[model samples]
Target: MLALASFISKHHPTLPITLISTADAASTPPSVTYRRLPDLAPPQPPIKNPVESFFETHRLHKPNLRAALVEISEKSRIAALVLDIFCNAAFHVSAALGIPTDFYVSNGSPGAAVFLNFPTMDETLDVDIGDMNDYLHFPGFPAIHSTPSKTVVFLCFGRRGLHSAEQLKETAVALERSGHRFLWSVRNPPGKGGDVPNLEEILPEGFLERTKEKGFVVRSWAPQSEVLSHEAVAGFVTHCGRSSVMEAVSSGVAMIAWPIDAKQKMNKVFLVEEMKAALPLDTGEGGLVTADELERRVRELMDATTGRAIRHRVAEMKASAAAAVGENGSSVLALHKFINDCCGRADG
Candidate 1:
């Protein structure tokens, strides 16, 4: 939200802008004053319960957040609390203080779709989430086509401590040998030659160079929004993080969910079976996929008939997302409402 904060500051300089972050982020930019809070660390192997996870993260930082709130509430005439929906404690804090609050789903439409319970692909034991079977069968959405078969695609792992290097390599090799074109965003950490082997060295020999044309391998942080918006990007292999989900839906991209941490699994369920815009991958025992299986699925998804249908549906979804945020759009109206409600006037 730093980008949003910056935009707001530039557009409305008279508004007092104090950003609350962790102590590590105390050296924030000049336009915004930084109030340091505590940091949060997640559990190893990660937990599946979203409620439990939320409390744990907040517990680490709540004391500092409360202190910041106390100071702000006492000194300034606070207007409104605009918060990310995932930031669970913000709502309660604002309510306790009787401040008007607006929840912002930073991840956008796809993220919002999950929250709203859009229809999704069906799941059976052993088999991963298949391609879109129908037009998601949701209200306000037109009937779109679904693919028959899909690849056993696994997306990028977020900072949720989900997939290990061993697992990533294992999957990559399987896909490569299977003749399946895998599109992956493999970000290499800073510095070379260390305790952990880099992704470049971990894959099978000639794995990347051979599949250079077929597979899309982005080495650094990709312009995810743009990539998802591309025609070639038929299925999204995502960590099922809110931001990624939003980008995919906003761009009309389908998904292959492999939620790592946070409320990702919840998001996975919402998308795969609920939203119908994506399929789910198994976080099964061994967490390994064979090359033959990977190839069969990837070919199934990329086939002419399957790819074409998904493309059309995604195109429609793209329009809906655009409309949602367009001028006088739903999200725009919501923003206006929030502004008016908070400031008591549009001009403010």
Candidate 2:
């Protein structure tokens, strides 16, 4: 959204723009005004699932969001409201006020494709998600600590997707069994949130010391971009978040695509099936990935023949991604055309 907003501002210096969100903006460009929505303090945890809870909480702000839209619309005409794909509720609000709307899909093309194909999926896969007795798994889909240069595997599940303590211990077991160097970033388990956990209290007894020579674990957060771009970094074990995927592609690292929830399953399909730059890990009963499968996937990423093929494909993609942002690239041209269209409509 920032990229599009920034480009729009640059193209039409006189255009007035305001960005509204539930969260405070950081480092917003001077050309754009950032307005934060009223705070709805996060739901106290031990919630069923973090992702669902997050969306539900945001949905509660619809009344306030409508007010914000009205307040802003009263001040100046909104040319077009470019909304995040998940925030579809705002479409009705904008339409009621006679404002044009467009969706901002940060997930890029593959994600866009999935969004377009939802009807097909619904028709083909007949399962009532709301009526399910057992957990409905949307399938692909951890943390790491350091910069180990092409030698260690990096694991991170996005902010709200952290696994349970029991699962983390299983993950530790998998890393130990895999016999590869690793960096694991520890966080409070999903739905089990309170405070950052003590490593000793959760991990398998002797797990840290046993892998001390080859592993590094840090609490809560790690410098993802810095670590992923490091020359020593090998492969990423990720939740297939769009941001993470883009970062990995730019760094030319193939991935172990593990889709946690929501739209990530589609991302895993795009990365593993279409892009062929990632490998998928299968989950077992209760959605827990066994140590054996985790170990195998890690090895698959490190296997010379298969690993080299994925790396070569990702490198080619990296080059193409670079070219797309270069002079006269498709993305640049598309953005220019979009701005012109929006401005043209605004003028009319």
TM-score, per-candidate, Cα-based: 0.48, 0.56
lDDT of 1 by residue, 1-348 (tens): 576677788888777777775535644346677666755445434669988866667655666666678889898877887776667676777787788888778887765654554333233211123334332333344333333333323346554333455565666765676565466766543343443445567666677788786576655455667766665456677878888888888866666666666598899888767666665565446655444444444555555454445445565777888999999999999999997898875456
Model 2: how far residue 296 lies from native, Å: 0.3
Candidate 2 C-alpha RMSD relative to the actual structure:
25.3
Model 2 alpha-carbon miss at residue 92, Å: 84
- Weakest ten-residue segment in model 1 by summed lDDT: 121-130
RMSD of each: 24.7, 25.3
Worst 10 residues of 2 by lDDT: 137-146
Candidate 2 TM-score over all chains jointly = 0.56
Candidate 2 C-alpha lDDT tens digits along 215-254: 9988888888888888767789999999999999988887
